[model samples]
Target: MTQGASGRDGGNSLKARVKTAKSRTLASTLWLQRQLNDPYVARAKREGYRSRAAYKLIEIDERAHLLKPGQKIVDLGAAPGGWSQVAAAKIGADKPKGEAKGKVFAIDLLEMAPMPGVEFRQMDFLDPAAPQLLREWLGGPADVVLSDMAANATGHKKTDQLRIIGLVELAAEFACEILGPGGAFLAKVLQGGTDTALLARLKRDFAQVKHIKPPASRSGSSELYVLATGFRGRREATGEDGAG
Candidate 1:
């Protein structure tokens, strides 16, 4: 991939444009054009991140103050491993023999190339055994849970939004089960107005819940991230505290 001299720095060149080919659909051609013009994509290549999505997490953490050293983190749907790379570097997981050393467990249905300081697992997160296996691998509860998963888009707006919401809600439930007290959860969501129930649930279980759209996300995209911090720990129906 190559980038021209035009970007946020205000060079005088025009944005890179992709010409549609006989075999390429217009949508695919437009997407290729956008990727060619996106500064984050070029920056990710230069900075050694697996995907441009890494900057979204970086922007979120810059303000949220999550991903501290010595914390154990779980990355769901982590194939391509952009977020895992950031988490590993931030939490000192790549450091050898240090008090600040941390652990990162990343899982996805698709295979991922090996990354330094990351343990990758290829499996469905919804598998009944996954939560226990991930906890065992981490050697305890996780301090942070990150989910960048999204359902396959069917191109129907409402249906797509519902599918994404369902996936994030499941990720949230998984985080609630595995995060230790005062932990945090971040997951992708759509910007439709239908996530009130999810927000309410997060508000009840976490000290803070907010929606954010990072600068890395394209202006016209509906992508938003739900960040829940300060997990209050699990509770039973009787209002008794339960193990996380």
Candidate 2:
């Protein structure tokens, strides 16, 4: 992958302009302009990544050291398979005959193109049977759970934040159910970070929890990632211990 292509250095790169077209909406025109000039997009094309979003996971994993060979990973909302690609490479999931055999199970509502190491299920992760199916595919509890899921933008800030939070919460709950002891969870959230209630619940379950915004993310974007590491263990569904 090409270096020195951080989104923060956009001013240093030559800008690309999109010609106005009768068919293109204002939103699409602006999106095209941004994509055309985004160095990460260009680097993704050159490096054969599914999308520039792959770099976000790469940056986070570099710091957190979450993806290890021989580990089991669950990728939520893995459509387009950018994060899955990075996870597969880092965990050596694609290795055909290596002692360090890793596993990656991906779930998304939309269809994803197949990759060598990834096992994909096209279904709503909220479905009651999804967790069982994922465990069946993984053959064991997950070491890392990743969620880059995001709701469609309604152009309303508060409403959008709520939707984003709702997705993150569901993903977090699923992670709690499937992750083994000392596992890790990472999910995309908003600029203000996770809500208080959700953060408190995460703090109760994880030894270390924090928010991170990788340089690959556009500086102007409100997107951030919440990372929770050192999961104590799976909580009993019935609250057997009554430890809130």
Error of 2 at 69 (Å): 0.8
Q: lDDT of model 1 at residue 138?
A: 92
Residue 237 miss distance in model 2 (angstroms): 7.2
Each candidate's lDDT (Cα)? 0.87, 0.87
Residue pairs with colliding backbones in model 2 are none
Give one digit per residue, the lDDT tens place, for model 1 in 1-88: 2342236534544687788899999988999999877888878888799999998999999988899988999999998999999999
Each model's total of backbone clashes? 0, 0
The window of 10 residues in a row where model 2 has the poorest summed lDDT is: 235-244
In Å, residue 189's CA in model 2 sits off its true spot by: 0.4
Please report the TM-score between candidate 2 and the true structure: 0.92
Any runs in candidate 1 off by more than 4 Å, and if so which?
1-12, 97-100, 237-244
Q: TM-score winner among the candidates?
A: 2
Error of 1 at 14 (Å): 2.3
Error of 1 at 190 (Å): 1.1
